[model samples]
Target: MIRTIVGLIIVLALSVVVISSVPDYSLPSGLQGVGQDYTERGVNDTGSVNLVTAVVVAYRGLDTLGEVVVLFSASTAVVLVLTLVPMGANPTPSSSIVAFTSGVLPGSIVLFGIYIITHGHLSPGGGFPGGAVVASAFLLVMLGSNKIPGKSKLLASIESLAGVTFGLLGFWGMMMFGQFLNNMVLPAGSPGKLFSAGIIPLISLVIGAKVASELSGVFSSYRKAGGDE
Candidate 1:
């Protein structure tokens, strides 16, 4: 009861702060808040045809990186929690189902995910969604078979390396231009092309790999814990 009262007091304080921080009480019409500022400046600033990608992976990169870190932390927390419980023996494998799902579905999902991650500068999708799609392939693998041969370590390693690479690159930019995760670290080539948008695409790729690996590792851990039916 004391804990609940304290929690309510804290919540009330936070709500009051939020309410006081709002500049305008009335909601503006569409595009009034954001305006054309982002769209106007995005093309020249990041050189990505996809304004959303430029904003996410270039302009507001640090926030995205923080989000990835949160995801990674959540996955780690899950692993730690699951470690308290003893895992069961591996389930029985189905040869035909495993063979077909492993052969066909994973390949297609991975290919499409890669396409989305790579072409992010030119298209609608980027690292987060694409990585989720790629991780789905791993889910399919887990659901289809009992023993997944020798990829969990690799995935974990990739996830770690990608996260480190992202941080290092951000520091590299800070060294060069006094800005964390500066988009100007690399040359921004022609827009709407594969190699355009400076470090945006590179960051997207790293985020994609990290997200995919982290999610795959989590799903694999759950399956190992006998959460699978």
Candidate 2:
């Protein structure tokens, strides 16, 4: 009861503080400072037409790295939980329609995911979404097929390698250019082209690989842990 009271007090206090602070926080009318700079020089500076990608993979690449680390930690936690959880569930395959679609769609889904990852610098998709899409393919298989998929060891190895590759590329940039994950390591080709944007695509590839492997492994583990097979 004391803890509950304390929690309520804390929540109320926070709410009061936020309400008091609301007047002091004004919404920006438009882009200013860094935003302005990124808007103006982002394309020429990073050779990436997609300003967001330029910022994520070049200007503020460390932030993206931190996000990856967070994801890795989460995946690690899930794996630890996997060990604690019993894997005694046997999943029966789904109906014929689902089985057929699983066989049919996975290939296309995987291909589309790769396309999204590779073309991230030029388009609306990136590593996270693309990887999730790929992982969904694995999920489809798990839901529809009879055979157990996602070799945990292989997935883990791929995840580790992808993570290592991401760091190594950053280090490579640091060694030669003194900036980590510098996209200027290679020629930032003409914008809006497939070969443009230098290291951005490479970074996306690794990020996609890491995310896909982690999610696929988690899905497989869940399926084996008594979820829908």
Candidate 3:
């Protein structure tokens, strides 16, 4: 109760200070912010029409790569959990639901996911969301059929390859331009084209494949733990 009261008091004090300073607030002028600079030169620098994609995949490529590592770690943890604790048998689904999920939804989801990842430089969606969608295709298969389709070993191999490819590309860029993940190694063609962004698409594809394979492995582990055939 004392801690709650103190928290409320602090909130009230901060609110009062903000209210007092509201009238004095004025927008700064003269120098354009980095955001404006990114907008102005994003296409020219990264050859990606989507400024957000350029910022994420080019300007902050290292950070994006780190995020992929974090995701891979999380998926590994899930696999470890499955190894430790066996899951229960899954409840059977309706025939119609199974048919739809197995026959129709998986293909559509896979296609859309690939499209999203490949066209990320020109569109709003990127590798992360696209990867999740691709994983959902595996999930649909799991739910529709009583058995997991792909072998976990294959998925693990692909995941490892993708991670290695990403790291190798970064090193290659560093070797060529003296800067890690530098886009200067590859020619950045005209913006708004499919092949405009040099390494962005390649990186996105790797990330997508890595993520999809990792998540699929996680799902397969869970399925095996559940005693599903």
* Stretch of 10 with least lDDT, candidate 3: 86-95
Give lDDT per model, in order: 0.86, 0.86, 0.84
Model 2: CA > 4 A from native? 1-27
lDDT of 3 at 34: 91
User: Compared with the true structure, what per-residue lDDT tens digits does model 1 show for residues 1-229?
Assistant: 9999999999999999999999678865556435477787788888999998888888889999899989999999998887687876776765786757686788899899999999999999999989999999878877777673333579878999999999998998999999999989898888888998999888989999999999888887777677546
Top candidate, metric TM-score: 2
- Model 1 scores a TM of 0.82
Which lDDT tens digits does candidate 3 get at residues 67-143? 99898899989888877985566645547867565877898999999999999999987777888899999888887
Query: What residue runs in model 1 are displaced by over 4 Å at the alpha carbon?
Result: 1-30, 33-35, 92-99, 148-151
Q: Name the Cα RMSD for model 1.
A: 5.9
Q: In each prediction, how many residue pairs overlap at the backbone (N, C-alpha, C within less than 3 A)? A: 0, 0, 0
Instruction: Report the lDDT of model 2 for residue 115.
Output: 92
